[model samples]
Target: MTIVLHGIRNCDTMKKAFAWLDGQGLDWRLHDYKKEGIDRARLEGWVAKLGWEALLNRAGTTFRKLPDAEKAGLDAGKAVALMLAQPSMIKRPVAVAGEALLVGFDPARWSATLK
Candidate 1:
């Protein structure tokens, strides 16, 4: 199974995830959102599995900087559009392992899912 880890390379959370994966000795690939850029199809696929709320990074600076009007009225469609426009607004370190897509960094959840 191909394990793909997607996030900004410099993110502290991403670094921790990477370190954890490395410690586990799992072979995986990194898809840097800043470098590779995210597309609608991939984001949509993840949203379909995990829900837009799980994928959207409301805690991040990118989301905080958005105008109140822009942040308002969020449905799946609008969330996808916003996330597509700004990849950083999507949560960090979304991992795709085989057929599973995991959003955010939770060590216990990751261990369970990845195994």
Candidate 2:
């Protein structure tokens, strides 16, 4: 399985996810969206599959710091644009394995999908 993990390396959650994948002996690719930048098409697809609420990282500083105007009354296109412009605004450790895409890390779910 080819798993692609997306997040900033410095994030604690992302660090834990990487460590877990390594311990499991899973081969995966890391996409540091902070440096490489997020693709609009990919973000759109993720949003569609995961829904805006799931994809949006409300816990992150980026999202919390957004202006009220920017945060309020978001639509799909606008949300995608925001995420693309601010990759940190998206949730951490979004993993894509084949046609399966998962946002966030839950051990139970990871075990089911990756084990």
Candidate 3:
């Protein structure tokens, strides 16, 4: 099975994930939402499974730099809107394999999930 890793190309976490996936000899491809962008339907599906809070990178520079009003009172819809406009605001290295969706990189978790 091929795993699709979604994130920006320059992110440190994505770099690590790429190295790890390569070490494991897995067939993986990058989604690079920063360049390609993510669609509402797919984003909504991920939110349904992973929850928007988990998918949004609130701690990231992009989110932190947002105006106060933009960060306040966020819901799934608003969060989706923000992420759609700035895909970098979404969490890094979200790995998808068939029906499985992983929000962040964890070597142990990934090994188990891929197995």
Candidate 4:
């Protein structure tokens, strides 16, 4: 199984994820969207599995900076559009392990899902 963590390379949460995965002896790789770029197909696939609400990081600065109008109406399409325009808007460390889709950093959940 290919274990890939998607997020910015310099993000603190991403660093923690890196450490945790390394500590667990899992062979994982980082897909820094900022540098590598992300595609709609991949994001949409994740959104389909996890929901756009779970994928969109509203608490991040990128979302916070958006105008009220842009943030007002949100659905799967709008959420995907926003996240597509700004990759940073997606939650950190979205890990795709085989068929499992993990959002954010939760060691317990990751352990359970990965196991």
Candidate 5:
């Protein structure tokens, strides 16, 4: 399986996710969103699959720093636009493999979904 992992390289969660994937012997491509920049189309696609609430990382500093107005009244389109503008606002370790896309890395979920 060809997997594309997306996140900032220095993020602790992302670091763990990458280490786990490596230990699992999976060959994957890392899409460092901070460096490569996220595309609108791809962000929209993730929003379609996971919903805006799931895709957006409200727990992250990036999201916390956003103005209150921007955080409220968000639909998929609005959320996608925000994510495109600030990739760090998206959840960590978004993995795309074939037609399956995953948001965040829970070990059990990763084992079941990716295995």
Candidate 6:
């Protein structure tokens, strides 16, 4: 099975995830969303499985830079739209391993699920 890890290359969380993956000796490819851009269909699929709230990165600078009005009214559709426009606004290191989709870098969860 192919595992695709999506995030910005420079992100510290991504770096940790990469290190973890390397240490585990797992084969995976990194998809730099900032460089390649994100696909709406794939984003929507992740949202469908993980929920928009899970995918949205409200703690990030990109999300913080948005106007107050934009942050106030966030339904799934709006959140997905925002994420599509700004891929950085999506959480770091979204890894897809076979049929399983993982968001964020949880070493414990990775060990349980990916390993």
Q: Per-residue lDDT tens digits of candidate 3, residues 1-115? A: 9999999899999999999999999999999886788999999999989889999999999999999999999999999999989998999888999998998889999999986
lDDT per prediction?
0.91, 0.87, 0.92, 0.92, 0.88, 0.93
Query: Using Cα atoms with residue i matched to residue i, what is each candidate's TM-score against the true structure?
Result: 0.96, 0.95, 0.96, 0.96, 0.94, 0.97
Lowest summed lDDT window (length 10), candidate 6 = 1-10
> What local lDDT score does residue 14 receive in model 4, on the 0 to 100 scale?
96
User: What TM-score does candidate 6 get on C-alpha atoms?
Assistant: 0.97
lDDT, candidate 6, at 105: 98
Q: Order the candidates by lDDT, highest first — what do you get?
A: 6, 4, 3, 1, 5, 2
Give the per-residue lDDT digits (tens) of candidate 2, residues 1-115.
8699999899988888998999999999899987888888888888878798889888888888899999889888878888888899889889999888889987679889887
Residue 32 error for model 3, in Å? 1.1
lDDT of 2 at 110: 88
Candidate 5 vs candidate 6: which has greater TM-score?
6
List ranges where model 5 is wrong by over 4 Å: none
- In candidate 2, where is summed lDDT lowest over 10 consecutive residues? 106-115
Judge candidate 3 at residue 42 and give its lDDT.
Answer: 92
Worst 10 residues of 5 by lDDT: 41-50
The C-alpha local distance difference test score for the whole of candidate 6 amounts to 0.93
Clashes of each: 0, 0, 0, 0, 0, 0
Q: Which candidate has the top score in lDDT?
A: 6
Write one digit per residue (lDDT tens) for candidate 5, span 77-100: 888888889999999889998888
Model 2, runs deviating above 4 Å: none
TM-score: the better of candidates 4 and 5: 4
* Candidate 4 lDDT over residue span 1-115, tens digit each: 6599999999999999999998888889889998988899999999988899999999999999999999997999999999999999999989988888899999999989875
Question: Per-residue error at 55 for model 6, in Å?
Answer: 0.6
Better of 1 and 5 by TM-score: 1
Pairs that collide, model 3: none
